[model samples]
Target: MARMISYCMRIIEIPMLYLQKRLGISRLAWVFLLPNLLLFGLFAFLPVVLNFVYAMTGSDQILLQDRTFVGMGNYQTLTSCEDFLNPNSCKDDLFWRAVYNTFWFVLLQVGFMVGFALLTALMLNSKIRARGFFRSVFFFPVLLSPVVVALIWKWILQREGLANAALEGMGFDTINWLLDRHWAFFWSVFISVWAHMGFYTLILLAGLQAIPRDVYEAASMDAASPFRTFRRITLPLLMPTMIVVLVLSLIKSVQTFDEVYAFTGGGPGSATTLLIQYVYETGFAGTPRLFGLASAASILLAVVLVILTCLQLWASRRNVNG
Candidate 1:
């Protein structure tokens, strides 16, 4: 096997040597990156182009050629409303409800997720017993598949499941957690936070460790209170990482679907229905399967995501410049 590998490499080296001679060392980066670039173009760029094409064409047919061109019609349909405040007034009421739900989900999920992650990161960074074990314990959930996490939580939250049983044992009524709209929305946010907080905590923990110990020593020498030191020193140094966490969490929260789908099935009359669910149902699962409108909704979502990503990039560049 080694001899065969050597022979194959030797055969490949002749062409590589020729190409290196043609391109020179200065351009070798592109040569090294060419395969990945080609794959990205094929998988990433091609799909985006196709999605845009689908957005402009209207039809239930899977074939693009059979779809009729209806430029801007889907977008107009999605945006039109008699009263923007009331979703019932809109032509695409479900879209607006999804939008409204998504807006709240992003707000609550990102806010709570980042807050919990920061707190966990701070605790994990401090001197404590079994610190390594605790870190591992916190991060364990992130390693689980989203489906598995959802199923586990579903069992725990169900009426005849462990949670209700525990409640009954404790002499409290077993609340139907998933049946109520308010509780369903709450659990959707809670489960997402529980499942993903550790990853962000790890990021923030790294940011914490990168701060120099000598700075803290100086603060202590000056008799700074713990709160004062954290506020004055730690927060300033960690702002860049915080910004990164915020943007990433915000983007992830906006795109939430899989775990949510498995957990609540966007249940109790679209209480937990999000934008991605709306798009998925419209594009593939609904009776008519309005591909054009679904594509347009996804396009709108992509635009928001692009704007968020650009914000992150801008912040990073500014942080670096300083």
Candidate 2:
């Protein structure tokens, strides 16, 4: 193994020596970066440029050259509606529905995810049996693929699954959980929180542990109750970490797809459809795929994400400064 490594290093050194002489040492770094730069430009930058271009064009044709320039026609169509609150009144009703669903989903998911994460962090931070074991168990779900998480929940919530089975065992009639619009939305938020809560919990736990032991000791010396200690010391100290978690979870909730997609398929008659799913369906899944409309939706979604990204940066900077 050592000899094989030496031979490989020798082969690599030959090219490095040759390149160093040709490009000069300082400029040679660009050679190594060239491939990565090209890939970034091709995959990231080019798609962004094309998305803008596609947003300005019309027609169902996939190729850019084939599509006719329609200026902001796609954007206009999305915004064209008599009653903004009433999706049925819009030109593209589905877009408005998706926007509303996304709004609620983000609100509910972010709130519950952060709340439960903080609660779990508090519990885990306390002296308890199998604390380390429980921490590992909580975080294990975060390791699973989003699709896998969705499928697990989907099976458990289905008609004949354990959820219904439990209900029936108590003499309640078994009913489909995923087929009801309200229940489907509830499960979507619940599943999202369950899969991701551990991650935020770990962050909050770190913040909790970082609170100086002396502070808690002093609080105890004053006979501070648990609630008082938490409100005065723990909550204030944990605020920065909570802000970080809030921004991150907000972004993730806005860009929600994959798991929710696999779990509900934006179903119970488009009750759970989000902005990202709307983009996917418009661009790829639907017949006569409206690439222009999809690109416009994407641009809108990107704007929201950029705002959230800015919030994240501000929170991160503040955390570092303090």
Candidate 3:
């Protein structure tokens, strides 16, 4: 009995020692994490907080100088101003048109981008010849700067450019790919999807590879069809990744500016104008900048993004649970 007690005491002491060691390791990990946490708070968290505070002010003038606290007045003005929020405003229908254009862009871009990315990822994951070469070719676009992508596409879509030249060669009429309002919007969506699909495909491919082969094998042995295996085994396992891709694509499409600016310059009657570009025009485009109105618009845009992000988080959680 004494030997048994001694053996039990030794086992308990071993775990206690291990616990102490783990605590020390955790402390070291946290110490290494502190600098990154501080940097994130300074850069990311501070900017968001400052933006919120600036949204309540009347001007972008230095906070210590010409700025005045406007409470919800900025938001109120935005809601009431027909020129800002209503669709009938003349000098420009920009405010509401930007909102409408952004919505359609997000919807179409997210749908096609995510769908095509999933298809590409699945194909790459299957037994294919030159899989590595195919992946690299598909992913090459992701390495290009947004400016470069926009410029290349812009040149290609011009009147005497590659696209029109090809069409002319095929005995088709040379269509104004970027000059016409409707066609400009169409090409913008197309280019944006093409530029972004590669990155999302790689992400989905990583997620696909992480799914255990045993799950598919089990489904196969059960005489399940390929469609059934994908429906029951693959999608559920890939839900988290799909949610991530959806939220990222949605946010990116909503905030898009560079490609639109480069390709259409928000022209041909402002058909491809986005919220961010509108904010830029309002704040800096004219001689007398409407800083107050621009700030108000930006606040509204931020609010929309926050709401969408919250909804996405809720949906993702529900998907995980289900």
Once fitted onto the true fold, the runs of candidate 2 whose alpha carbons sit more than 4 angstroms away are: 1-32
lDDT (10s digit) by residue, model 3, range 210-262: 99999998988999999999999899999888988999889888999988888
- The order of the candidates by TM-score, greatest first, is 2, 1, 3
TM-score of each: 0.90, 0.91, 0.78
**Model 1 C-alpha lDDT per residue in residues 157-178, reported as the tens digit of each score:** 9989899999999999999999
lDDT of 2: 0.96
What C-alpha lDDT, on a 0 to 100 scale, does residue 12 get in candidate 2? 96
Error of 2 at 32 (Å): 5.3
Question: What are the root-mean-square deviations of the candidates from the true structure over C-alphas?
Answer: 2.7, 2.7, 8.8
Cα-based lDDT for every prediction: 0.93, 0.96, 0.84
- How displaced is residue 262 in candidate 2, in Å? 0.9
Q: Which ten residues in a row have the lowest lDDT in candidate 2?
A: 172-181
Clashes of each: 0, 0, 0
Candidate 2, residues 1-322, lDDT tens digits: the string is 9999999999999999999999899999999999999999999999999999999999999988899999999999999999999999999999999999999999999999999999999999999999999999999999999999999999899988989999989999988889999999999999999999999999999999999999999999999999999999999999999999999999989999999999999998999999999999999999999999999999999999999999999999999999
Which residue pairs clash within candidate 2?
none
| Model 3 pairs whose backbones collide | none
